[model samples]
Target chain A: MSQHYRTLTANSSSYFVLVLALTALALFGLAAAHYMESEGHWITGMNNQIVWGLPHVFAISLILSASGALNVASMASLFGKTEYSAWSRFSGLLAISLLMGGLLVLVLDLGRPDRLIVAITHYNFKSIFAWNIFLYTGFIVLVAIYLWFLFERKMNQYVKVAGLFAFGWRFILTAGTGSIFGFIVARQFYHSAMMIPLFIVLSLSLGTSVFILVTQIVGRLSGSFMKQEISFSLLRLLGLLLALEGFLICAFYLTGLYSAARYDVVLFVLINGGIYTFLFWAGQIVIGTVVPLGLIFLAKAQLNSSIRLVSATVSKMIGSFCLLYVMVIAGQSYPQLMFPGKQIRSTFFDGVVVHYAPSWPELALGMGGVAVVGIIILVVTRVLPFLPVEEQRAQSSQ
Target chain B: MSGSSENLGSVDLKRRKFMVTMVASMAGAGFNLVELAMAKTSLEAESKLVRWGLLIDTEKCGVGCNACVSACNTEHNLEDHGRPETDAQWIRKLDLVDEQTSHVHSLPMLCQHCEHPPCVDVCPTGASFRRDDGIVLVDKHTCIGCRYCMIACPYKARSFIHENLTNQRSWSPRGKGVVESCTFCTHRVDTGRIPACVEACHAEGGGAMTFGDMVNPESEISHRLKSEPSRQIREDLKLNTGVRYQNV
Candidate 1:
């Protein structure tokens, strides 16, 4: 049976309010970025010690999730899961929207946001960051073309090829993101080959969680429904991804714990680094990983599937943020090991774990990126027939 | 003396007049007399033959001697913003106490100017670069202030400018939102002078610092490095840092 999609009516008062709210938040975020740039980064909590702060955590999470958002579309086209084909168009749109949101944060957070043109024009092949610029833009273009193929009846023949290409590019995109930290040999926390796989899995977990949340919220608001089986299947996929994410995170820290050189940093994050330690165990490992896993696998029989799914996805989202916060911010906060077996002191914050408290503007800028994603999805669904509609159910609802 | 005067008087009048006229014109047009005297002008461009480096004898570096740091600040016009964490420190005094032995070592730490700089490797815009003379410098024009170089530098030698400023030195040319670090006093080095830190260390502190050409075997730095035991800070990375330390 041919699946049908429909444009959102967008006549509801609630939808209008949401669109207005998201737009306001996005604009506020832009204003925050402007203030930070005009006055200087000192207004923010970021110092020389922690160069990248909250903005990085938010930006990286969205970017990784963007790739993962396309997983449903990949499943339909690449893995031949026909049940998932209905969700493909929405998935493609969500992927692009999420990427645009993430890119906005990353670019605006730059010291010279005005030199964005320079970043685009210049190419440093050895730098993973340069490679990511290409990967990010290329993924958007490829996914758009894939979406085009899915939309046009005449172009249906080559959808698989486009899907395959996009699928491959997203892996590289996520790898490039992970390698941003992995390639930093100077830091005790990074410079491991395992960063690539860990990031890829993270993208999968975060992306799937986001897709599930969006799928349900949009479905309910648009007065459409999916087969409970399909919803259950998506939850199962997220559960598997979370398990993989947990395993990789453990392996990453365990390997570092084995090395005496990496022991201090590991101990700091896992045990006694205060806020960082708490975020890792309570926010990242327990809430982000284990709780979600338990809720999905164990609580499924007793709880409503929708409630279980939402709780798990929301928990995972919180956990993902914690994980990134600990990884990016805490990773830099730890002092560089200049002298291996000596206590070194300097005015430049050497030999001490630097303190960073995210300023208001930084928080505003990060939240704004999330808002941008929401506004994009809201506007796009209204203008275009991106929403999946079950034909029989649509007729019954009308 | 009379015979020498008679020989000088016998010299061609026109040649002497032409030489005087040329020197006066060049001087009027803002020529550096020092550059002329050195014979190898700055316009000749830096050469690979001259690898500028420093050798610091940590044993001679006295505790609480802020002369080197003070000189570096004065030279670079590094103003104190009262926020040490965010302030631009071109050079700072470092105190290292052995965990096992309790022996304290005091030294001044700054950019090492590595032969293969990680900052240059990781710079997305090619802003961070190493000159032919082995003086690593950041071309601020291309620096997006990404701080990747700051992350890549093992010594934590780089500083990101965090606030707006006025009265920046014409020679230094620093601004907010860009990364800066020890340039090995490139402005002074280009004009045939030692770095401010080294000069101050020699004159006011413990005479711990030596600045010279590492490539020149006849130079004091090369002689000292070959004759005595000197080591790079992180030898395992094999960055081949131009700066070396002795008796740490």
Candidate 2:
């Protein structure tokens, strides 16, 4: 019976309420997307200067985290962490669900959402965006295969090969996502080779943090308990990855500031560029980087106690959100340089910072992407034998 | 009998020579006809023979000259819609001041139409493309409206049509969500006519802009380019833009 994992069984009333709430959130997101399509982009905060808006922030965050979710499974199978073997199926399932949620936001936000067929049919092979469509879809397929390898007892020996392939596939897939911005030669906030590695590490940290939060929440809901050893070990790894994320970000800025052409953007992001500066320092750094890192290591210092695990999870989630917000939205708000040294003036607001406040509908849509992930997790756990069978006891029967 | 046989042989040889020469001439005529047809098609089709470029003499450009802007608006029917904040600007005047010397100059800026355009490179659907003639344009039909091209454009030369577009110019069709920019007036160029902005600048004032074939070396723009030194905006990127500015 391959350890006899079971689908969760909840009270009908609670299940109904949960499904209904998730359905409502998903519907709201769909409605918002429809409105945006009908009303035109003028309704959104996005303009000529700031082409991407909250949608990108939401979608990219989910997408990156999806790739991150695979790491736990990869650890168990590929790296031979047998104890992690329990949560392995759940991790693969989480990755696919997160990825689909993220893709929903992206597709809905497209200017010609109607022309999605065109994006699929007609591709510029040179484009990173084109490469991403394949990367994203391929990721789903690969994860499914990995999950199958775990589910079928006879196919279990293929786990190592499948996990290894899946791990490498996700690394390249995420790098392709980062390279979407990295290839831009015009924008100061982008075009760094560091973005590729940054995305890879960011995906690991954010995805792992998300996986931890989801694991705990699902465990509480399903009345199952993850071993204390597994929980704390994952938390410690999260802390280390978060620290690595901060380090890589510093290296990115350091290299950028060295070049005069890129320095204006760096200064704007960190110091003087009004709202952008606040977001970077306060939203991303103080909340996302500093506090999460502090909470994680502080939790670690307590001899890896389970009581501190909650604080660690909360902080990492906050950090992940803040960093993503800074990278996606705030980054776009900063102006692109036309003339490096010229005092630029224009009616078009050249060389001036653009203000972007996401409308309510946009916020709803972003939440929708998050809610979509939740609903997927709920439904998947209900149907698939994703959870580890803790006991062959009477508790599981209830 | 021997004399008659010799006579018969000579007649047969003459007939064979005649047949060979006749077929050879017919084949030569068919070859010439095919050559003519190919030549005609080549002449009729658009050629990349001469790269169309612009030479803007910023020295002659006057301050507060809205002529080019107005002419472009009329040509493309760019609706102000009383929302300057959101209205699309195919071309706009830039006021540039030298940081070191405090020197100021006014010049129009739009799509540079680089030989190597970042917009075209980033577009997932090859909607944003450069014509063989060096004019960069957006194919609204194919555009999924991703707007990555807008982010990639260093000059901020692209604009997204935010409002549901109405009364779009027959010559310049635009739609909401589609990214558009100065097409260098491709329709006008096709008909052997100058762009509305260029014509306005010349007919009215600022005689600052020159549009012609830079590849010809004999064209007026090519002559002016050779006579005086001009520089491209953000020349460091080496995009090889069709648009050039003189004296910054």
Candidate 3:
């Protein structure tokens, strides 16, 4: 056995602790899911006005992350870029995990989660959300098949083709998910034609960052020496994407602020007034994007050292978290009406303005989904050859 | 022998063409018959014309009384008066204003009962549906409480009961996690009685609230529309709302 493998196997206590923590989280998530099912959507803080809540935000995040992971695989296989191939298996696993997590969050968010199968079977082809169901299912299947071919069987051109398809389809799928909000012509905040493209770009950044962070953490825990160059390149790419996303976000807000529409004013309040303001400025922009970008840039300038590696990994995780936060708030902030000549003030609750907040049980269930994904990835990595064992063997032989 | 063979071939071809044409005509007739049968069955099933509707005249609406709102609550067994911010009002008197001139107008607003309701269009579970009689109602049994209907509604008429609600009588028939909205006092309308709000308004001698079938020319609502100068909340949107405001 390799020295690294020996070290990983020897650290039984840490592995046990991690397993216990993840298991506890999973159990909590299952309990929350059960409670939500029995109690109905009333368990969540979501009211009529604030219909979409934390679960929706988290689900969108998972989708973006899943898509981004596919991008990594695409670059490696289809683009004939060998640098990303090393992390392809890990990235593929993360994509599947994120998608599963997203689907769970969405199902739980449904008024009738049991009717999810009905949603898939009886599709409203005109509805973007209906199309998303098929896209997400297809994307998951493609990723699974590609992973099976890569890890279980020999790496062939066919697997690469499948990976390419998954990668390309994910972009369209993520854009379609964004179009759920985008196609709401009634909602001025989401009415802009740019939402689909914005979502695609945002997903690419968030998904890529998550892929890097997960792999780095896993590599550290499993005593696998992931190439520093590969990690750095990913961090650099993610930073660039984050910068572009930031620019778009700024442009979106500026356009809203200047527009002479009532909905625009409402959006402005959501962004600048109270909790959402802090969430946007601090959580989304500063901590999520700018700081992470700065960290990655500084680390890259300093070269491939331990500090650079740690900074890049941590920043990526934070950036991904921030992107999810923004998606959730942005999705719910806009009311679905043109209130120009109406007498209604459009408050959070009452009349047309129903109040909505995610309940504790709903939030716990969402968190539990994250835990389940982590556990799944951990188990899959252990049982299956997620990392290239052949590459390691070749290095040893050399 | 050659002549006999050619004649036989021609006869066979002609017979085949005639059979094909006959079958095609029969199939077309068969499809039309099936369509007619399906239409008849639908008509039989949906014979009951329950065109539930509401009419609000801003002219006679007493601004401070809010009797219509109170009556709706009493009849529907809704929670008592809540704070303006957290209130669940089926009927609301909106204080409208001209943004440029600072001119204010109080218009009582509720479910418009729109002809092309955006809410019904977006419902994923078909929980929010429009009746053949132009009444929009929710199926409590099928409602997963997704609240997509709430988001899609232009009037913002839909309200979600956030907490666990009980003791809700059949008159209202709302529970926790299901979206509730102004059903034009469907239970009352189903009987001979007008909506609670309309009755309350009439009792107050304001005559602002009118309840009748818009489709029926003989209906009081149609007569009022012809006699009185009334306007919809957002007439520009062209929703063909059942509820109309007069003297705003």
Candidate 4:
């Protein structure tokens, strides 16, 4: 609870080069967004049929994980876990940067990105998309306030209230993100109320996975380590959350498949849907759910070992990305049913499984978001104290 | 007492005016509301009083005939630039084959212009909106091109302009980086003329499409729907589409 934090000197050539590289990547993303905005979305692989592509996948995953990142702060302040309070500031910082990264991608992907102000000014209470604009903005502000409370010793008492607000806000934010797809009645795959909970579980697992990775990086860079016991506890919690997420996904898939109306979609997702099937089973089921579960469920003797922690963390990270990719991309590629009793043939690719191969620009922009987040973290950690409490070192010391 | 009495007099006058309006409306209730409106103003403005709709007799739609699609393309200045995947299809014949019986039914699919449009419901900027006369449209000025409406549309009727567009019709203003769909030939419909597709169908394809006001029971589409038993595509969604199909 009495942890004293300090900023990194970040004087090493390698560290400077890493920051420079990430900044370049972020700038490249901005350039790509500008090019697409000026030229058209046709430059990207997104067409009239598969309107959303890699941009959406990356954006949603980042945003959901951003909300999850705040779990550390929430547990610390909101749930009265004083030990985690040491890391709450770091959580708040990561959460803000992640949200900014995700939001930049989403805004740039808009067909009329120039008229972004219109989106904010207009109110469509019925639309989940409209609600999300507020949710996302509210989260950033809440994170800022939570971090402020952490930094300002006098206002530490209000940290709990801010964390509570942030906790509730993020719940709605992630739920709204899921509902964007779920409330879509036109599609065979989405429209279940259960998607809300499914996404929440997804956010928790992915969030924790990202947190574990950040913690490791923080420990390495700052030379102040998270206690072995705390790391173990966090990993175990991640494993439990992943298991819950796995159950929810399975239950959701089965429930959706059971409906006669959705039988075709189920077949497409599980059987005939080529890339979609691969993504669902191989990418999501095996890599994401299974590997993490396997790593986390290791025997107590192995679990206590440092090697086990690193392996588990790495697998969990891979798993989160895989599941999110499947959830976003494959979920969209499947054809929507316009006619229940009839097979359709059309030039507009109606009533057919659509394939989405994201072009170079799309992939660049997607990774740009990650680079932006990384750059922010790097710069912030160097300028401000975001690491665990350690002996203060002057800016001259590397 | 005098001030109170004057106030009572104004209140009495308001009540008297309300009674007069109520009595007048009640009297005109015997006549069609559209007819009674002749006293107020000319029907020159396309009033929401009429809900325009289309009744398509799918049985009469000729196989391999793309008269309607061709007409829609020309009418809206929708050019095909060798990219069928990205081009906007204002209307196209959906060649539907019954999976079990192998029975085939072909019907032109376009924007349904539902009474409760999902596109309108999901648009973040409220740009996707339904006109009072039952025509759904996107206000390009306000549309941020987010394409959430496309995600919400049940019929897959919407299209996004993937490439930079040029040579657009003055009547149908379109541009790149914005979502667009069939406006049901609003320019022609506003002028009290049938949609280009309906005219095309009557001329070249087949006498399959009937366009008129669904709100008017005496209108051809209204009468046809009532007599022939037509159905809206995805009727389960309860969108109450302005477009209907018969003998599918």
Q: Per-candidate DockQ versus the true complex?
A: 0.60, 0.52, 0.17, 0.55
Per-residue alpha-carbon lDDT of candidate 4 for residues A27-145, written as tens digits (9 for 90 to 100): 88889998998888877888887888888889988998899988888899877787677788889998998899999899988888888888878888888899999999999998999
Superior candidate under TM-score, 1 versus 3: 1
Q: Candidate 4: list runs displaced more than 4 Å.
A: A299-307, A390-398, B1-44
Q: Considering TM-score, which of the candidate structures 1 and 2 is the better prediction for this target?
A: 1
Checking candidate 4 for backbone clashes, the offending pairs are none
Tens digits of per-residue lDDT, candidate 2, A1-398, equal: 34668786665576668778988999999999999988888888877777888888889989999999988999999888987888899899989999999999998888889998999899998888999999999999999998898999899999899999899999999999999988888887887999999999989988988888887777766765567668778878987887888899899889989988788778877888777678777766787777766776654565445446666666666666766766766566776777767887888878677787788777888889889999988988898888887732433453
Model 1: fraction of the reference interface contacts it also forms: 0.74
Worst 10 residues of 2 chain B by lDDT: B37-46
Candidate scoring better on lDDT of 1 and 4: 1
Q: What DockQ does predicted model 2 obtain?
A: 0.52
Which 10-residue window of candidate 4 chain A scores lowest in summed lDDT?
A: A389-398
lDDT of 2 by residue, B161-194 (tens): 8878788889898898788999888777766678
Candidate ordering by TM-score (highest first): 1, 4, 2, 3
The number of the candidate with the highest DockQ is 1
Tens-place lDDT per residue, model 1, A211-290, is: 98987777666765555677778888999998888889989999999987678998999988999999999999899988
RMSD of 3: 15.5
Model 2, residue pairs in steric clash: A288-A319
Output the lDDT of residue A361, model 1: 92
RMSD of 2: 12.0
Per-model lDDT: 0.89, 0.84, 0.69, 0.83
What's the i-RMS of each model? 0.9, 1.1, 3.7, 1.1
